[model samples]
Structure formats: C-alpha cells, structure tokens
Target: MSHAPTTLQERPTPAPAVATTSLSSRTLPRWAPLGFAAVAIVLGVGLGLVAGWHSRIQWGLLSALFFVAISYTVTTAVENKRQAKDRLATSVVWVCFVLAVVPLASLTWTTLSRGAKVVDGYFLTHSMAGVLGTEPGGGVYHALVGTLEQVGIATAISAPIGLLTAVYLVEYGKGALARAVTFFVDVMTGIPSIVAGLFILSIMLMAELKPSGLMGSLALTILMIPVVVRSTEEMLKLVPNELREASLALGIPKWRTILKVVLPTAIGGITTGVMLAIARIAGETAPIMLLVFGSQLINTNPFEGAQSSLPFYIWEQYKIGSEASYDRAWGAALVLIAFVMILNLVARGIARWKAPKTGR
Candidate 1:
C-alpha cells in the first residue's frame, strides 16, 4: 500500500556525445599544397617529355593546370565540396598571378641581358655623329638630351593648363561650358598621337616653320594635356567635400580655400598625375618623327633645329637593319624603359612626401 504511494525516482538523462574530429583530419596538412605542387610539376615534366614538347612554357602551363585539378580532387576527397571549391579558387588566383608575372619577368630579363652589353658610360655620353649605323660606336647623348628637353617643354606647357582646367571642372564647373570641356577632354584622350602630330604639322606648315623640337613639343603637349586633365580631375574629386565646407565656414574665399586647403591636400596626386603624363608623352615616336625630323648630331636648341629622341633613335637604328643597329635599338629601348621607370619612382616619392598627414 505504501509502495503504491511512493513515486519512482527519475533517472537523469545523459547528454549526447559530440562527434570529435582532429584538426589535421578536418583540414589539409600544412605541407599539402607544396607537395601537390611538386607532384604536379613532376607529372607535367614527365608528360611533356613523353609528348616531345619542346617549350618550357607548355610544361609550366601543364603543371599549373595539374596543380589546380589535383588540389580540387584532393580537397574534395579529404574535406567537403565547399573546401574543395575554395582551394580551387585559390589555385586559380595563384596561377593567374604567376601567368601575369612571367611575361613581365621575361621581358625585363631579356632587356637587361641584351641591353647591358651596350649600356655603358660611353654609350650614355656620346652621340651618333660620325659612326655609321652598320658600325657600332655611338651613344644616345643627343637623343637623351632631345627627349629631356621636349618632354620638359611639353610638361611645362601642359601641366599648368591641365591643372587649371581640372580645377575648374572639379571646383567651379556648373553649366554647359564644363560639360563641353569634359566632352573635349574625353575626345582628346582617344585622339591618336599621329593626329596631334598632324595638327601641329599643319600649323607649322601654315607658319612656314621647319620641323623642329619645338613643333614636336607642341604635339606632345596636345597629347599630354588630356591625360593630365583627367588624372588631376580624378585626384581633385577624391578630396572630401567636408574639408571644403569647413574651410568655407571659416570665411575663406573659395579661391583661397582651394589654393591653400584643397590643393595642398591633393598636391601629391596632382604631381603624380603630371609625372605620369610626362612619361606618356616621353616615348611618342609619331609626333617626334612628324615634327622633330630626327637628327644624328646633338641639337640642344629645341626651338631652331631637328632633334633626336630615344624613340626616334630606336626607329632610325632599327631601319638600318644591321647587327650594330639592332644593338643600338635595344639599348635605346632599355633607356626609354629606364626613363619611364625613373619617372614613376619619382612620382611615388613625391606622392609619399606630399601625402596628407593624419592625426592619431
């Protein structure tokens, strides 16, 4: 009777056991990708040899493909479909990066290896005055000088005008005039260098002016202005409106505010844009050919006589069709590349120097 009234003690339910996995089991090993890559490379080389493929590029491509496929297959088997997809994407990105870098590396190596033979102090300081194109004993002095002068003149003429135009467009532009200016700039951006050269040639012909470095500079100016304008406009647009408003609230005239606050803030980018524009025009051969009338002797006076530039020198040497001429062309090309690289480096330095400092 008492047992009937007594309640049975309830047994506590045990918590369900969690499924445990070792970290190594759930994910790929640290050395897995390297091992896969090594295996892929070995297989690629073996297959290439068996197939009698001569090009190393083919082998590399095959290796990259194998790497991606192997990574996906292994990941899928070891992990899940999602992990395999991620590994596949990663492999694809790495392959793309290598593909992009390989060409640039090859070009640089080719240039350096070939150009070093002729790029010495003597090559830098002399001019192609007396030595025949078939005989190798000349330098790039005249061409270097002409390039610097013409590019300098073009920069001088284009930079201020472009900066002002960009300023007007970004800061003071309001109506149809701004839109028209923008339209013209866009049109000019796509205008062929030869067209600009022809336009300047027409003007020179009208003025009865002979082909000279000045004429070449005018054409380069035309080509450079659009680049500078577009680049500077973008840079100025990146400036914060809040800064402008803050300056205006302090009773600063719009012009003064732009000159002091806006320009200073964006000066780094503006300088970089101007330098890039200079680099863009530096290697233009069409304008130089149409106007500068390539010369063999040094012509420091850009206003009066024909001049030789790096591009013109390269072209002239290439036309000669001699071993010496080929060497000179390669040398000139290397120099031109170095010039552009130096400009870019200078732009980066200036950008860093003039970058706005932020308070912590």
Candidate 2:
C-alpha cells in the first residue's frame, strides 16, 4: 500500500488574475442614463430662455424636452454609455416639474378668469335668487345641499356592498362565481355615467321612484360600486399570506384574521379609494338630471322630493336665457371644483396618516 504522507499535500492555487478578470467584467447597473439627462436639461433650459418662449406653451415644451433628455441620459448611463448621470437626471426632473406646474397654473388662471364674474358675496349667500336677466347676482345653496345628500346616500349604499363583495372575492370566493364577479366588476368599471342614469331611470319608471334625489342616489350607487370593489380588492390583495397563515396558526377563525390583520393593513388605501369613488360620481350631471330633477330652490327631503345639486344647477342655469343664470353657473362650477379638490386633499392626508410603517 502506498503510504499517505502525514502532512497533506495541497494543489497549487491559480493567480488572482481570474478573480480580477471576473470583477472587471461586471457590467454597470442600468441607472447610468441619469447623467445624460442632467446634461440635456441644463443645455436645453439655457437654449429655451435664449429663444423667446416665455408663455405657458413654451414652458410645457421645454419641460417635455427636458424629460426626454433626462430619460435618454438615464438609459445611456445604465448601459454605461455616459458619465454625467446625476446632472442629467436633475435637469430632466426640473423640466418635468416645470411642465407639471404649467397645466395647474393654466387651469387656475382660466378658472379664475371665467369664474370671478360670479364669485361675489351674493353669489355665495344668495340662492339663485332673481336670476331673471343680464345684471348678475345669485348663489348655489340649494345645489350644494342636494349634492351632499345625493353623494352621502350613495356612499352609504355602495360602501357596504362593495366592501363585502371585495372581501368575499379575496377571502372566500372559489372558482366560477369569483371569475364571474371579477368579469362583471371589470365591465362595470367602464360603465358610462349616462348609462347608469338610464338604468336608474328605467328602475324608477318601474317602481315610480321618479325624479327625486333618492333616485339620484341610486344611480350614484351603481356608478360608485365598481370603483369601490376594484380598489378594495387591490388593497386586500396586498396583505401578505404570512399574516393569514399566522392568524390561522393561532387557531383564530379566518374571518377574525381578515378583520384584525388584513383589513387593518389595507384600511388606509381602502378609505382613500372610497373617497375617490365619491368624488368620481359627485359631478355626474346626467344621473342628477334624470333622477333628481334639479330645482333652483333648496329641497332637503332626498327621499320624497326633488333636489338640486351643484352640477345639475350648473347645467340648468347655463341653459336658461339670463346672464345672471350664466354667472351663477360659473360660480357654482368653481365651488364644486373646490369641493372636489378638498376631498382629494383629505383623502391624501388620510392615506398618509393611516399607512402602516414597515421598518422596526
């Protein structure tokens, strides 16, 4: 037998050239294009100012150009095609920012310009009072109440059904029924507001809930449900499977798991989605026109009597043959827009405040 040496023999090691070669072969990360973006933006902005483009349109163009330049730079940088990624990214971002600002600025300018004629104290305090002819004065008090009632009722009706349906789809729904619901929700997502109005009108014709704010609420429910379901479903899906497994592992019922863990995790997003759904239907004129039958005077009884809403009032006033009516329409439109803006801001705030912190 060949005697084995007490000291073990060792194989010769290769030089570090292989490791160095491997290291050198490592390609750069794709984020490199950020450099070109910087260079393009600085270059483009200087060029824009040199040209006589001080208008909103000019700003928009410059912004777009800057975005493209930055995007190109980032792409190139990622591919190791450029060296100046940071500056390129910055320029592009600024350009995009400027572009974004222009539209909001234009919208504010246009809305104020057109709406100021109707935004007097009388416009805020007085109902569409004495809006008979050219000399203007009137407000949107009645419409405001109607809008609140209609949207409130819609939220009340839609929230339960939509949220429950989403829960079932996510937690309990199995095969065919779930697929059917998903398909229908997808279809409903794109249902035109006018179609929802028609559907409600047809139902009202059948049961004779005709031309009341209740009927308007019904139409809004149809419009709001799909949005709620879609958003809630997406939110619920974001809940980790581990949460479900852990709750079950603790011998808790599935329902409790959903209530305690899943819902709490996703509640922030759900609330924001619900608010957005409300905003979506708030401005629908067709449904209100068909169901509520807008009036100039306020009617608080959403169940029994016809009511007016800001959108419907705007529609009605704009059609009337009086300058006062037109002015009131613009003023009412501004108020409606303002309300929508506030709702969006509130939703954003709620989302931020309630969102779960991820880190320890």
Candidate 3:
C-alpha cells in the first residue's frame, strides 16, 4: 500500500531594509580659524585694557588660550569628541608655532630698525683704522674681509675630510675603529666653541706663533667638521641600497659606484649640511677673538697679520660703551644675521637644483 502525496507550501523570507539617520556631526566652515582668531583677539584686547595690562605679549598669550578653549568647546558641540580633540591639538600646535615665531620676528625687526641707522656706503666701505670707536665713521670692511677668508679656508679644509669620513662610516664602517670614530665625532659635536679656541690658542703658544686668522680658521675647522660629518653621514645613509647593488652587478668597482652613483644621489643633502656647518661657525666670536686678535685695519693676508671678523667687530664695538659704537655693533649683528640667512637660502637653492629628478 502507498501513502498519498502531501501538498508543498513555500514562503521567502525578505531582507532587512537599510535604516539611515539624519544626525551627522556638523562640518566646520573653512573660515573657522580666521573667525576664531578674530574673536580671540578682540576679547583679549578688551580684557587686557580692562585689567590695565599694557604688554602686548600678555594680550597675545591670553588670546591664544582663549582661541584654544573656544575652538575645543565649539568643535565638541558642533562636531564630535574626536574632532574636538583634533581641533584642540591643532590649536595648541598653532599657538606654539606663533609663540616661537614672535620672539624671532621681534628680534629681527629690532635689529633691522637699529642697524639701518649705521649700515650705509660709508659704514660698509671704510676701515676703522684711523677712526675711533666713538667717532662713528668706521666700517666693517676689514672685519668682512677676515670673515670671508677665514670661513672660506675653514670650509675648504673641513668639507673634503668630513665627507670622506662620512662615506667611510656609511659605506664600509665596521668593528671598533668605526665605533671609535663615531664616538669621537659625537664628542667633537658637543665641545664648546670657546674650548676649541683654547685648544688652538694652546697650540699656538706652544709653537710660538702669533694670533692670526689662520689660527682662527683652525679653531673653526674643529667646530665645523663634526657637524659636516654627522649631516653627510645621514645623507649618505638615505641613498637606496638597491642603487649600490645595481652598480656593483654592472661590474663597476665599489669606489667608483660610491663616487658616481651614491655621491651624486645624495650630493644635495651633503651640500646643504656643509652650508649649515659653515653658517654655524661663521658667527663664532670666542674663537675669532682669541686667535684672530681683531685688527682695525684691512688684513689681506690671514696668515701674516691680525684680522677682524664680524663677531669680533661687534664685540669690540659693544665694549666701547658709546652710542656710535652701539650703533655699529647693531649694524654688525644685522650683517652677520643677513650673511647666515643668505647662506641658508643658497643651500636650499643648491639642494633643489642638485636633487635627483624622480620622473622623466
């Protein structure tokens, strides 16, 4: 006997509908920072006046604090906790940046204002040989010459040695000798400029040699070499290992590969480092004062006679304790700063020019 067939029934279960909500955080306007800054400034100025505070610095500090607080609060309400936290951090960073910049800007502005009074054709061209410190008619011509010659000599001596040392450390350094060299380089980096001067001075005394720009250059070379080495080492380390291996696979010698491939690849950074080192030593006064034995007259021969540098000139002028001397000191300071700035600009330009092209 067979059982009768039963009727089959089927039903499809439907998928859940997608649900959406209209409660997204509001986006901050692009001009929010500007608006916040404006409000902060107004409130800060008002509060400063009401509190009888005259210093603009205090006002600015208050404004920065207010901006940060307001930014955090507004972002929290309109956006979310994460956005608020981000805005808070951004505000703090902006405040720190402004704070750091303010003092530098003030110093530069003050220097430009005070130095402009004494920086002129006569001030730049004439020597202080016949002119007295209080007479206000002298120039930095001799000092300028000395600075150029000493720095040029120091750079010429330090750059090659520092670069080679850096190359050795990065390309082939191994074992205790490399470690010792690195340790000494680090130690040299921390030594005071004055200490370097003292070292040279001691050497000069022992050798019975008189103070001269040549001696100053020796001291500067000590202070400059470590900086150059460290910077160049870092640049060399940044070169890709694949490039070196590729050159080796092509039957090129290791030395030739390093010289032609690696050096070219990292030349821009190395040059930048060298220029920075030059700037670091250029404004040093202690070494120059001890070794160069500042001269009022133009000394064309750094090896033969006493010479003057910008820092030494500034020091001498400031020590005279006269209005004219003070002006001259300010002028020298401005010139020195300008020289350093010019060097930085040139370094950046060279780095950009020499940097390898990534795309055809």
Q: Least lDDT summed over 10 consecutive residues: which range in candidate 2?
A: 20-29
Clashes of each: 0, 17, 0
Candidate 1: give the clashing pairs: none
Q: Model 3: how large is the Cα RMSD against the reference? A: 5.0
Off by over 4 Å in 2: 1-59, 66-80, 83-101, 113-117, 120-122, 320-326, 348-360
Segments of candidate 1 deviating more than 4 angstroms: 1-25
Q: Could you estimate the TM-score for every candidate?
A: 0.89, 0.75, 0.90
Write model 1 residue lDDT over 252-323, tens digit each, in one string. 999999998899899888988898888889889999999999999999999998998999999999999999
What candidate 3 gets wrong by more than 4 Å, as runs, is: 1-25
lDDT of 2 by residue, 112-193 (tens): 7778877867676667655653556667788888898999999999999999999999999999999999999999999998
Q: Is candidate 1 or candidate 2 better by TM-score?
A: 1
Which has the better TM-score: candidate 1, or candidate 3?
3
Residue-level lDDT of model 3, residues 1-360, one tens digit each, is 999999878788898976643344387887898899999999999999999999999899989999999999998988888999999999999999999999999999999999999898888887898888887788998988999999999999999999999999999999999999999999999999999999999999999999889999999999999999999999999999999999999999999999999998998999989998999999899999889889999999989889999999999999999999999999989988988888889888988887778896
- Between 2 and 3, whose TM-score is larger? 3
* Strongest candidate by TM-score: 3
